[model samples]
Target: MKIDSRAASRTLAEIGNWRAVLLHGDDAGLIRERARACVRLVGGSTDDPFRVAILDADQHARIEEEAGALSLIGGRRAVWVREVQDSALAGVMAALSLDTDTLLVLEAPGLAARAKLRTTLEGHRSVAVIGCYPEEGRALAGSLSGLFRDASVSIDRDALTWLSSVLGADRGAVRQEVEKLILYAGEGGRLGLDDVQDCIGDSATATLDDATSAAMAGDRVSADTALERALAEGLSPIALARACLSLMTRLGKVMGWMDEGKSRQEALKQLRPPVFFRKAESFGKALERWDRETLARACEAVQGFERACKQTGSPDLALSRRLIAQLCLGPRSFRG
Candidate 1:
C-alpha cells in the first residue's frame, strides 16, 4: 500500500514479507541499499539458487512474463531492476500491480512530480516506496557510524568528517571510501585520521581541506596552487565555492559545541564518523576571521558564481575566476 518509507522499512523488518515493493531513490546506491535491506527484512534464503534478473522497458513483455513466474528452488526470491527511466513507469506499474508473490523491486531515478508511476506507487494500496536522497551532513555521519558499528570496528571522528568532505555527494561512493577506511584498519583495534588520509585515494581526497586550510592559514601560495589544481582538474569556481560553503557549515556546528560544555574529545565521540581535530581548529579560526555575516555573504556570492557557470561558457570564465580569487582573498583573521 502507499506507505511512508519509515513505515515500509519497519513493516519489511517485522512482517518480513514484502510481497512487491517499488524501491525509489535519487541515487543508484540508495536504491540498491534499500533493496538489500528489503531482502534482509524478508529473511530471504541465500543458500538456494537466486536470481538477479534485470529487465528494461524495451523488454516489457519479458518482464511481465518473468514477474508471473513462481519461486524457483530458493527459499525466497527477489527481482531487481536498475536504471529505470520514466518511459518505463507505465509498464512497471502494470508489472507491479499484478499479484506475483515474488518481490518485484523497482530502482528508478528521481521521478517527476507529475509522473504516473510515482502517482501509482504513492497511491497504491499494496505497494511500498522507499525514497533515498543524496546524503550529506548528519545522514552521512550516521551512515558512517552505523557502518563501523556493524563491522565491530571503531573509526576516528575526525577521520569520518575529513573522509566525507573529500568524497563526492554520491552515497555509494562515500560508502566505498568508508569501506576502504575500514579495510585500512589493519591489525589495530582503532583507526584514526592518519590512517584515513593514507588510505583515501587522490580522487576522493578532500582537496578542499588543503585549499581551505591554505586560505585559512593565509598561505597565498598553497591556496593558489590548490585552486589552480582544482580548476585544472575540471571543477568550476561554483563547485569550489559550494564545497567550501559545505565545509564551513560543518565546521561551524562543531565550533558551536565549544560553548556547549562539551569537550572536543567528547564532541568528537558524539560526532558520527568525525571531523579531523586539525581541520576543526582551522575551521574555528576561519569562522572567527570570516564571522557569521561574512560567511553568509560569501555563500550567497558563491550561488551567483554557480549561476554564471551554468548560464554561459567562455564569457563567464573571467567572472568565475574573479569569484574564486575573492573567496581566497577575503580578509583573513586568526582567533587564538
Candidate 2:
C-alpha cells in the first residue's frame, strides 16, 4: 500500500510488518534518510553484516536470495538496496513474494509517476511505498524552524525568511547548510538575519539577486555587470531568469497588499522573504516604477525568457542579456 508523507513516520515505525518498503522521490536526501531509518529498525545498525545485506543497483538480482537467507545472529534481516532502478522490478517483486520476516528496503530517487517499479510496489498488499519530494513555502519554513528548535537554537523571523529564500531545492543540500548554521551558532545560540547572512548567504545567489534588483530598478549598467558576474560565477541563465520571476512575484504581492489599503512600508514588511535592509531602497524604487499591469506583463515575459533558455541550440546568454537590458529600460522597451 502507498503511504502518504504525513503517515510515513507511523508506517516506518511498523516497518517490520511489511515484506518490502520502497522509498522513491525527487528528494534523494529524504529517501536515503527514511531508508536508513527502515534498515535500522529491522537490523540493529545499517552496517551490521550479520543482520543487514547492502546491495547496489548492479546486485539487485541477489535481493530475493539475500532477503530470504536467515541472519547468522538468528534475528530478522534487512536487505538494503541503494539506487534501485526499473530493471530491478523483477528482483523486487520476487523478494516481495517471500513469506520471510526479513525487511526489504529499496531507495529509488527520481522515479517518475508511471514507473513500473513504483506502481507495482504501490499495489502490493504487503509493501509500503512512500514518496519523498522537496518541501516549499510554509512546509519548508516549518522544517527549518523544527531543525533549529531540535538543536535548542532560536532563529529570528527575518533570518528564517532569508534562509528559505536562498536555500536550494535539494533537501540534502538544504539540510547540510542548516547543519552548518547550527554549528556556527553554538548550543542554545540565537540566529538573527546577520548570522544567517554571514553563514548561509551564497555568493552566486547574491549576485543573481543583485542582477535582478538592478534590472527591475532600471539601473542598466549595474544590471548588466551583475548579470555578467553571476554568469561568470557559474550560475545558469535559467537560474537568473527564475530569480527575476521570483522578484516579480514578490513585488506583485507587495502591490496586492498596497491595493488592500496597506501602506507601502506595511506591504513590504509583509513579504515572506522580507527585502534585505541594504536592498530595501532599490526594491522600493522598483516598486514605484512598476504598476500592477506592467508588473504582470513583465512576469509573463520572464517566464518566456526561462522557456527560451531551455530550448536546444538557443543562445541563452545573449537572450538573458537582452531580457535584462529590456527590463532595465522599462516596459516601453519590452517586445511583444
Candidate 3:
C-alpha cells in the first residue's frame, strides 16, 4: 500500500476502494491535490457540509466517532484529517477500525521512513500511503501530460517540453498554469510552444528565481525589485520566503564544499541544476560572504519565520518580506 510517484496516477485513478489513505510529503500542493482526488473518487464533496468533514491535528480525538457516523445527505462519507503526524496516529488507528462506508484521508508533511504512522499505514492492507515528492525529468513530463489530458487540452510535444520546464515542482502551480492554458486554448484548441511562451512567460516563478539569486548574491536593489515584481504577480510572501530558504540551503552546501578545499568553480559545478554561467560570479561572492555555520543559522531563522507566518493573527506577508530583506543584507544581519 506504499505508492511512489510513478504509480501515483494509477493509484489515484483506482483509489475508491481504499478505506484509509495517508498522503504525506514535502510538496504541500501535491498532498492537498491527492487528498482532494481521494475525496472525489469516493464520491465526497467539501461543498456538502454533512457528507464531508475536514479536521485538523488537534481535532483528531473526534475522528473515530466522526468516521462511524452515517452521512446525513445519504452518500459515502469522507473525513479529511490535515497535518497528521505522530500525535494523530492513535485517532487514525481507531478510525481505521471502523466498518463503514467512510473514507479517511490523512494529509501530513513529509514523514520519515521509520515514522510509526507511515509504517503502520503501509503495513495495512486497507490503507494506502503515498509519498508526494517533487517529480523531475521524464516523470515530470508524464505528469504534465496527464494533467493536460484531464483538462481535455491538446498540446504538442515541443509545447509540452517547454511547459514542463516552465512549471516548478509545486503541483498547485502546475495546476494553475494548466488551467490558464486551457482557458486560453478555448474549446478543442491545439497548443504549441509559442502558446506556452505567450501565456506563461515572465511569470512569478521566473521573477522569484531571479529574486532568490539576487538576494543570496548580496544585490539588495535587484533583489528588492524582483521581490516587488513577484509579490505584484500574486506570489505569497510565505512561498517566496520558502524559496529563499531553499536557495540558501543549496548555497550552504556549495560553501561547505569550498571550505573543504574545493575550488569555487568545482563547488558550483557540483550543484544539480549547475549555477548559470552569467551568475557564477555572484554565487562565488555569496560564498565569500557566508560560511557553513551562518547558513545553518539562517536556515533555522527562515524556518522559524515560516512557522510564525502560519500562526493566527500574524502578518505573514509583511513578516516574510522583512525576513527576506534581512537575508539579502547577509548573515550578519540575519544573526542580529
Candidate 4:
C-alpha cells in the first residue's frame, strides 16, 4: 500500500495494520506523525509515548525478529529505524520478509526512484510506502484556506501566493509563517499582500537568505561574509553546514534535470523558494562554477563539519569560515 503525503487525512484513516511502512520526506516531523498514527491504529497506546519500539538499522533484523516472534508487554509493538537509507536496508528487509505482526517503520530522507527499499515497499502488498514533499499551489492554497478557516480569518489571494513562494523547500517554515500571519492579522481580519510584505516578505532576503544567494552565486567574499553574519546571528554552524550541503545537492539535482532537456521554467517550478524565480539566477551561477564532482566534494566537506559539530566543542565559526573559504575558492585539495 502507498499513501501520498498530500492525502494525510485519508492516509491516517487507512493505516491500521501492523505491517511494514517506509516513511520518507524532507520534513522530518511529518514522517514521525504518520508513523505515530499507524502505531495508534494498531491498538498501540499513545498515552505512553515511549511504549513504541525505537531501534536503528544496526539492530533492525534482530528487532524485527523479536517484534514478530513475541507479543508486546500487553501493548502494541512498533519498530522504527531512523536514517536508514534504501541501499543499506537489504538484509534487514530480507529478514522482515519472514514475519508481519509488528509494525516496522523505515524512516529515510527523500526518495529518488533509484531507492530500492522504496521500490520494494511499493511493490509489497503487506508494506506501505509514504513520500512527503513540500506542498505548493493548490495543495498550499487548500492548506492556507484550512488554516484561515480554522481561525476564521480571511486572506487575499496575493498574500497566499507570496506565502507559497517565499517559504522554500521548508515545510515547517511555511507552517510557522502561516501561524505568524494568523497572529499578526488577528482573528477575522482580512490579510492582503501588504500584510505579508510587512511581516515575512520584508525580511525575505534579509539575513541567511542573502548568504544563501551569495554562496550560490559563487561570490566567495559575500558568501564568507554571509556565513559570518549568520553565525553571529546565533545560527548554529551545524545547521548552516547542512543547509550548504542541501543547496549543493538540490541544485545538482535540478541542473541534472535541466540537462535532461527540462525547460528553464520547468526547472524553476521544480526548485523551492529563492531557487524558483528570485534565487534561481544565483543557483545557476553556483552550478556553473562547481560541477558535479565539485558538488560531491562539497558534500564530503559538509560531512566533515557535521562530525566536528557533533563530536567536539570546537569554535564552529572559525572552522566554518575556513571550510567556506576553502570551498568557495575550490575543492579541498586531497593529499592522497
Query: Which lDDT values do the candidates have, in the order given?
Result: 0.61, 0.83, 0.77, 0.64
In the range 1-336, model 4's lDDT, one tens digit per residue, is 576655657755766553777778655545665666676676465444344666665665565454565443555566666766765566556646765566676777556666777777787787777786545446766777888878878988766755654444444455666788889979888889778778875332234455665765657888777666666655555545655665676777777887899985687577643343455577667766766666777778778885786555687777767767666665434212
Judging by TM-score against the true structure, name the best candidate. Answer: 2
Off by over 4 Å in 1: 1-16, 36-50, 56-61, 71-76, 156-167, 186-188, 201-205, 208-245, 248-275, 280-336
lDDT of 4 at 148: 84
- Find the 10 residues in a row with the least total lDDT in model 4: 201-210
Evaluate residue 130 in candidate 3 and report its C-alpha lDDT on the 0 to 100 scale.
Answer: 88
Cα deviation of 157 in candidate 4 (Å)? 2.6
- What would the per-residue lDDT of candidate 1 be over residues 89-149, giving only the tens digit for each residue? 6666666667766666677755555677767677775667666665666666777788878
Please report the candidate that would top lDDT against the real structure. 2
- lDDT score of residue 76 within candidate 4: 51
Cα error, candidate 3, residue 43 (Å): 2.4
Q: Which stretches of candidate 3 lie over 4 Å from their true place?
A: 72-74, 110-114, 156-159, 213-220, 234-336
TM per candidate comes to: 0.66, 0.71, 0.70, 0.55
Reference-based lDDT, residue 191, model 1 = 73
Alpha-carbon error at 132 in model 2, in Å? 2.1
lDDT of 1 at 27: 55
Query: What's the CA error at residue 314 for candidate 2, in Å?
Result: 14
Backbone clashes (count) for model 4: 0
